[model samples]
Target: MEILSKNLQLLHFLDKEDMAGFWKLKMMILKITSHSWRNWISI
Candidate 1:
């Protein structure tokens, strides 16, 4: 039972890390897309 609980805690920690990475990737994509659109409009 203790091992199972520890495993659950580890999973939770990994999930949080994954979420942070996901947000960072999303922001990068948004920034790239917006920059492309601006360049497109200028042309």
Candidate 2:
């Protein structure tokens, strides 16, 4: 959880630095994690 939060902070910082790539990467990560969470909950 700490690592995740740190990574999220890094992503946010990168988003501020380079909006386009950051937005794309952020969305992709969000989609992947959201799907994983859903699957985990279902199990």
User: Which candidate leads in lDDT?
Assistant: 1
Error of 2 at 2 (Å): 20
* TM-score of decoy 2: 0.57
lDDT of 2 by residue, 7-43 (tens): 8888777645588876889999999999999999999
Model 2, stretches more than 4 Å misplaced?
1-17
Q: Which window of 10 residues has the lowest lDDT sum in candidate 2?
A: 13-22
The sequence of per-residue lDDT tens digits that candidate 1 reaches over residues 1-40 is 9999998887677877797897999999999999999999
* Candidate 1 lDDT score relative to the true structure: 0.91
User: What's the CA RMSD for each of the models?
Assistant: 8.4, 6.4
Q: List the residue pairs that clash in candidate 1.
A: none
What shift in Å separates residue 39 of candidate 2 from its native position after superposition? 0.4
